[model samples]
Target chain A: MAAEVEVVKNKQVLLKDYVTGFPKESDVIISTENTISLKVPENSSGVLVKNLYLSCDPFMRGLMRKPAPNSRTPLPAYKPASPIYGFVVAKVVDSSHPKFKKDDLVWGLAGWEEYSLITETDLLFKIEHTDVPLSYYTGILGLAGITAYGGFYEVCNPKKGEKVFVSAASGAVGQLVGQFAKLTGCYVVGSAGSKEKVDLLKNKFGFDGAFNYKEEHDLDAALKRHFPQGIDIYFENVGGKMLDAVLLNMNMFGRIAVCGMISQYNLDEPEGVKNLMWLIHKRINMRGYSAAEYYPHYTKFLDLVLPHIREKKITYVEDIAEGLESVPAALAGLFSGRNVGKQVIVVARE
Target chain B: MAAEVEVVKNKQVLLKDYVTGFPKESDVIISTENTISLKVPENSSGVLVKNLYLSCDPFMRGLMRKPAPNSRTPLPAYKPASPIYGFVVAKVVDSSHPKFKKDDLVWGLAGWEEYSLITETDLLFKIEHTDVPLSYYTGILGLAGITAYGGFYEVCNPKKGEKVFVSAASGAVGQLVGQFAKLTGCYVVGSAGSKEKVDLLKNKFGFDGAFNYKEEHDLDAALKRHFPQGIDIYFENVGGKMLDAVLLNMNMFGRIAVCGMISQYNLDEPEGVKNLMWLIHKRINMRGYSAAEYYPHYTKFLDLVLPHIREKKITYVEDIAEGLESVPAALAGLFSGRNVGKQVIVVARE
Candidate 1:
């Protein structure tokens, strides 16, 4: 006879409706009406997990908006009144899959809920090392890290002594890219939203220089001051005005890696990048990429990053919230630059 | 003593002033006052050439405008009341440089005059095979051919059966790019301004299909109808609305080789490309390059294209205007798409 499964109340963060402009905490609802069985269904190749950590990412805001009519890759919209999904770290409570068993810790796409039945086992990656904080899997050890790695090393192909510039420098991917540039013996400068984040980038991350973009009235002048010789590699995170200024200040044969356009995501019409003619004059190569495309190299990226973290040569900062109730505000905080670093919600303690 | 060197009348096309908006024939003056020595200067390494053919390119319009204050590469603006300089095929009347002697055929940058004292002989290429038309060196056998070859094969990295599209389909670079795409076994489509040019693209160039972009009211709908599976490679010669529309119809992992943006050149304010978000969604790589960058590969390019010309696998067309007096009108006609193919001025007959 099969063992009986325990059923318990499951608290979830649900999307109320499609968001327009700036997302608010009221856009999502916290509900405790749902229940989950702490066991994989019989004959089902799935895993049941107790959700521990949920990631708050900028891309989530794009998902909140109604998909474009001709959107080639329309990410499935967050269903109204349903649990919102994102990257999460969880402990497996039960498993019918051959690779996972009870108590196997893992991280991948999951719901903002107390418990989740992960039928898409292919997306989940088993956590190998527990010495580090498990929440690191929600960011530094996961997709954000891969994005920084692939975008900088593979896409930009940074050379020693090259001048590198990164926007949103205090954020998850930007911070890591700055450190990676420093590690490769390149001169690195970063721009952030606040004085505190600027100091963090300079003192903690060991960036060559850091600036508060808000304080500078003219972005072009600020860039000219920082990159007097012009930027060799621009790791683009915040697009729009920043991109326009960067185009004017880019060196001949410069490379721009388009990771995300955070500033343009909320606007009804994206800001016009006026200085694109510079792409021709300077012979610039601008390419856009997603970290999900580099999943096959996840293990390669881990192998490169793990040793640096272990030796304290590299460090990661995360702004974390506690419990399922903090989920809405945590996610909304990303757009307003309310979070200092990688934003994570601790759904439950280990 | 050597035969007394003769001084001769030099007919020159001089820019009356820095132009704004659309260029007019009146903006340039045909000067007969200029005189040239039929001999190379003593103790100088310069080669004097009797100009035969001059090429009319869209980039010359940029040279006619006053240099931008913040321009990174301020291409020495055409001085008011001085003859403009452009690519020319000429006969070496006398030489002090070791590479050339009297009567040697060469093609490179020269003044738009009957005679030019070529001091910058380093950029000039000696005509080895007069078997092909010497005029071919002014275009398909010169910069335009290299631009198409390098931009298409090297930048686009096209694969067999990939969908390819070219804007300015009947113009100098676009015509060659269409032929190159067909050579690679790709499904090729082109966009021109007139029905005659469109027919030339389909019949003469052997493109799979062609469209007159001017007749199409809805650019995006035209792109969608033509590229139902979406464009894998877009050889961007005309920018503005065509680029915006192409962005919407691009397949995942599309590549756009930006050789020129003729549509934006004449406008005081260049049009903004709005659908750039498609870059991130589709993971597109858009690169801007110039033929000058590929000069070192000129020999390799000639080796590939000469055989095609001989075998009739490729052919070229030129809208020829006789004498230097027609230089201004020939140049201004480029902006209006009045020239059918490569526009060349017959400065003198071979």
Candidate 2:
């Protein structure tokens, strides 16, 4: 006996076309014409999910562009008139896959629409710990969390008493990296775009020092002032002039873990970095990494960070936008620094 | 009774003043005004050596400049009116230091003069194997040898069948790095400034592909032509635009070991690198290192390379400058890409 299929309106934020420079709200369209089935089709290996949360990450800017020929970008590009997708927290409505089932809480690659039929279950993760806010699954407990773990703990390999500096502090991963550095017993300083964010970095993230980068005319002088003894580790989020300044103040054998270069993502021509020669003079090690590469460490990362979150040893801040329709403004706001901490959009509460 | 101290005329290449940019022969003065004895002074643990071979290395340009305030450059600056010094192959004439003795051959840091009283014998290494040409000590057995060994083997960590690229490919360290990549079972390409050096890279260094970077309008396109699969490892001897181009053509998880940035050394304001954002996309690991730091691996490096030299499996080219008088021109010529190979100034044959 066959059962009647349940269909519902699936509101989405669709990409109009590939972005050239800075993305705008006009680049995305709010569409409600699509209807999605709540059931996974018979004999099909797919999971039907109700999107609960969608992340507004800086890396999304890359996905909005048409990839160059022979480009090796690990993430897939968005297709025109299709719902843009990224790391998301969703509730499984139904599943034909063995790993996921109905009512299962999960977080991973999903669409920005109200409902998504995820075909690749490999990118999905079944959420285990739900005591702390489920909204965290969109950020600190998801890709952003493991990114800080891999880039800082694995790449930078910070040691106790080492001096650490983080640019774009108070943002999703930067905020986490600062907290991680503090937990590692390193003296850490962070630079943010706003005084309010700087305050959050020092007060909320427990950074040893914090500064508003917008007020400083000389980035190099700013770094020198905060890092008088020279920085031993740099968690690079913003690139360009800030990266150049950090290079000048880097200690010998210092490490720079480049998780993102948000500053150059929108430029027609990315800004040139002038101080890379210092890498040789100071024997610095600088590496770039994506958090998805560290998914294998999710369980281990959870074991370490979950307890810290509960014990108040570490904390996370998120700026959430209500409803799926808000994604156009929310995603565009990321480049303009309109949101604080992790920028996330809510499609549903549960 | 003290033994007779036989004083002799000591010719030196002295720095007239700290250079501002693009060193000219006039910046360095040839002076024969000094005289030195063949014996170490009383109560001093110094070693006196008659310079046989003086290495004309690119790093010397950094020392010729007045170092920036609070700069973390590991190399010391050359004082005005003082004889500049660098790695040299010499015969120990006399020594009060326990490690060195009269007539024993050595290679290490020494003055750019006929005879030098070297107080820092710690930097010196006794010449153990004399079967190879003594001139080889100025290059293949000295800092240039280890610079290539460390930057390629220790830093780049090349895997078999990987693609490798060397910038400034016909220079001292770059020549060796290309050969080392070939020895490691890697496909190697080299970029030089002139057609003659490009021929040397292919014919002498056994590079799979050689291109005159000066002839290429777009370095990125040139790299793409040579490295269709993209570069897995880069031995970065020349920074600036070369580094930027290499970044564009790097494969995922590529490693770049920057031993020197010869192109940027003489610039008042070093050229800006525009493609650093690719570092993030490609997940590249770029590190800088000085061969001196890898002195501990000198013996292991020798054991591996000596046999290759003996079996003619590897070869070295030397651009021999005839006398101390030729140094002013030789040192300045390095900036203008005048030297075809490892430049060595011969003060004495034996």
Candidate 3:
């Protein structure tokens, strides 16, 4: 009865089973009954982290299902009795790894539980800038930030004064891409699921123009009307019909940087693209990219982006959900366009 | 006694009307009535040429039809009552231009006639190295050759030890791309419509592997069988089903150079690609290019390829039709894959 108080317990959300169709909140259950020793064992290269914030992304929905047998992605099924892991910002309670230390802040792959023990030290990044919101490490200052940067600059190779179009422009990555394009002297336009998101892209993220894709009956015609000169660069976040429409309105030598295809992920089979033949006529360049492959440029990107954040030259918004129990609703919110900006789950206070 | 004259009249194949469906020999009528007095008017910027050879490419079929009102390409129906113009190897009978003179052999846009009066002098290239066959100028040493070189080297950006797949592998452009990939140390494989072309690619063109696409029931499986590592570069010539399959088998960071879509040109509506979603998953880069766009590099390309031709280091094959009257059948041969190598008509004796 050392303190005569409640033991600090870890809580997590577990997948009850593989999901089909739209995921329901009951597909996952929040449980709190675990504890990790706040000490690193001798000769062990492990770091015990108390997670502070977590990211909720659309791709997480893909991981809810048992991966197809011959799939190339490392999205294995979440064991029924275990916690799910994703990008998280945490405080290292104890560590034996030389690169990290006790009481240091870090961000990497962490479990939904309050505490996670990381064995592989290579994946973790020590947080250097504390002036910005720590929760940002889960979204804008983390994987999503680097993804929007690398996919737009390295993959799309955007030229100044070019016309840029982004799908899912109000989402985490899309919002950043639209802002980046605007900063780069491009005429940036975006498409969102609803009128509210469209307004956010224009007024909040400062996109040059925006449209509600749902209201447009003919996507190709809408694109033609908006981008009369044709799009020079397309940051593809939502695929399917949007991609098909983009193909029809691409200018000669246009570049498409494919980051994600959230629209087609839940479908039983992906939709067919009808305007692919336009690829030949317009002489477009479409390239896909993953952020994990571009980690070498992380420091360079941080140097470039962090100063902008401090100067208030770059602005970010977040939809924060409190407690680990709120993770289910936060994740489900991504598909319905409920998140206003970067979606995050705050687990605990500093 | 009258001069021993052969009547030396210009013979032309005039388009009777804009064609529909499959073109026939009756669509074009060969007549020997037109002659320009075999003279270049004083101060006129024209080169009177004795056409030696004419190229028959699938693009010519498009010229046979009326272009849609809003088409980006200027390709339109051949002037209703005029002779068709295309790539040709010709001897200048007379020239008002400074760079060319009588007896100067040149290759460029010329009428599908025994003799043509070319007004655009800048489009013509004076034959410098004719050590190889003259017909090679119409295929390997001409626009087709430049298309293969620029599209693969500039667009695809080949890396050594990369896996490269080319479609229509035994055609004028495909054979050269395979050879170029081989020279760059890429593991090159190609697909052809027939077994004979497959053998030609492996035995004659030094491709790493070859296959007849027409015989493969499952193109995705075929790609996996040949390229277990997946294709790093795809030189897309045929479109439709092959594109859908290749999308599934492209590696992360793969590049696709869309030079032509021979398969879809004759169709009333272009075939839809079903697996385009794979473009985002693998981070593939697909681009289309035209040889016309590489005009600035033509001199540099000629310097590189002409020497290869002179050394016999690069081999080119041509299927020759004996007269101007054979133009329509030769052009139609492109659609059915009936001609081996480049289908060319010998409009006049070289």
Candidate 4:
């Protein structure tokens, strides 16, 4: 038998227990007790990855809750005391896998830890272009970019001069959807939680109109004020009252691309959408989709967005926390609209 | 003016006033005061017809309510103390229009009376296939047929062996949608108000399962009992709480084609659907459309269903009243689920 390889301490963010109502930062625990053998085992074809950047995505909230009895979700809950996982930009520290070599850069699903032993095939994509900031692999050049591109062009089917409204406009996916709508010659409006984010949407993101929902007493009146002509396309992020208001103001034959429902994720009972009758009167299509469905179109998505990004015609903003221990707070803040842009964290550096 | 134009009494159903809640028979008046000339004006390109049968549709309730202060409907409210209009089967008494002449048979939007002078050029469809019962023109062969064909085939986008659920499953449109799904080799379930309608759906229309929703206190459990694998297509007719329940049982990538919400039309505040979060979880598409959108495809639709009707491969049922004076009760009964099948009333024999 070969001599045992050197082991190193691995810091991780672990789930404390199953969540109810809103998840608290205390639901996750940062631990430094775990250790890992940094070298790949001779019999395994897996790669040992050092997580460089980990994302705080809204969908991650689902993993903290106990799923409803008799219903099945696409993914399962994170085991108690186990490391939570999400989209990550990583460096392959060691590998026995045919597709990856030591020090190769990649982006895909990984654990919220200092390192991960990834054995699943097709779970990771080799980072192809390295000219841009590597952290972008956590968002714009990855999941967020593909989502906004596919959702706007394929699902909502926007046309020139259409009125597009995006909720959570400063979030990872919302910002890109607004920019994509603009590139398609649309009139865009966005809503966020704070005045600063609202200002970022209008002045920095080039939105035609922006409003802080927290300051507005009536969401319907605010939507009416921003969308005098009614919304032609609604990119849904925050659900509940915002969705109900958007439904009331959708134009004839409108489309709503439902990407996420950050507002409703933490609630014991999500608020009801009351104005769906407008769905019939206006002839709308409200579609819900997973970003994975568009993963196959990554090259096509890059072809459309990469050029505009290179010319500085399209821009992205990210709000990142530092270190692996920061994951819990950064993730919990998403439900409360605490982040200014795409929420991500730098876990480590090469 | 050359001769005193011959005129006759045209007994009609007239709206008493804009309705506030559940419409009553008292909300309409049977009037003998209306008179019509026996001929079309010489200068006009229009037809004067004696109405034979008029359809009692759920959508007619919209015409009863004065629209919201901030909104507009495609059609306006029925004028107080004036004749109401609907889909009608008629005999042309006189015509200056090139498409019709004396003794021509037709079906179109016409006044609920003994006679209608129709000036809208494209409103009428000349009855070309006379082999079937003429009353079929009021239900299966007219707007209901077109609505079912287009909504099921175009909107739901079903494939063989998929599961389908239709609400208000014994009504004019729902019956046809069920039969269409059966003919397409899909497993279908339906919900109706009465046991008689439920029996008709399963034994007559060949639906795989049928349930009286009024008897089921837990719609979600009822749906699960019928569709353990979850619903693939939901043809929404009765909205409100039923819609909320259906949302719970819909399969991933399921499609909901919204037709009418008879249960909601009379409600001052329609029930809010709370399970919309399932839309994101299941990746569903809920689309709402109008029957008018399918009118241009009448010929294509006829080509598909006409042969089935000839071969007795498809069947339709009607709950018809005997005279024009019965129109108010028959139409009002639709909202209460009082009619067993398609509701139609005879206005004249010839």
RMSD to truth, every model: 1.4, 1.3, 3.3, 1.6
Per-residue lDDT of model 2, residues A1-350, tens digit only: 78889999888889999998889989999998999888988778899999899988998999999888867678789999998889899999999888999999999998888999999888899999999999999889988899999999999999999999998888889999999998999999999889889889878889999988889999888888888899999999999999999998999899999999999999988888888878887899999988877999999999999999999888899999998778889888899888899998888898
Interface RMSD of 1: 1.5
How would you encode candidate 3's per-residue C-alpha lDDT over A95-207 as one tens digit per residue? 88888898899998877888888887666899999999999898788989999999998988888999999999988899999988988999999999888789889898899
Clashing pairs in 1: none
Q: Which residue runs does candidate 1 get wrong by more than 4 Å?
A: none
Q: What is the lDDT of residue B52 in candidate 3?
A: 94
Taking the tens digit of each residue's C-alpha lDDT, what string does model 1 give over B1-350? 77888999999999999998888888899999988889988977899999999989888988999887866563577999999998999999999989999999999999999999999876799989888888888899977888899999888999999999999989999999999999999999999999999989989999999999989999999988888999999999988889989988898889999889998888898887777777888889989888878989999999999999999999888888998989888888989899999999998987
| Model 2 superposed RMSD (Cα) | 1.3
* Lowest lDDT 10-residue stretch of candidate 1 chain A: A68-77
TM-scores, each model vs. reference:
0.98, 0.98, 0.92, 0.97
Q: What ordering of candidates by TM-score runs from best to worst?
A: 2, 1, 4, 3
Write down the C-alpha DockQ for each prediction.
0.65, 0.82, 0.58, 0.80
CA lDDT scores, all candidates in order? 0.90, 0.90, 0.85, 0.89
Query: Considering summed lDDT, which 10 consecutive residues are worst modelled in model 1 chain B?
Result: B68-77
Model 2 stretches with alpha carbons more than 4 Å out = none
Off by over 4 Å in 4: A1-4, B42-44
* Alpha-carbon lDDT of model 2: 0.90
Residues B270-336, candidate 4: write the lDDT tens digits.
7777888888889999999988889999998888888999999999999989998797789779888
True lDDT of residue A146, candidate 2:
93
Q: Which stretches of candidate 3 lie over 4 Å from their true place?
A: A1-8, A33-35, A41-43, A74-81, B1-10, B15-37, B41-44, B74-81
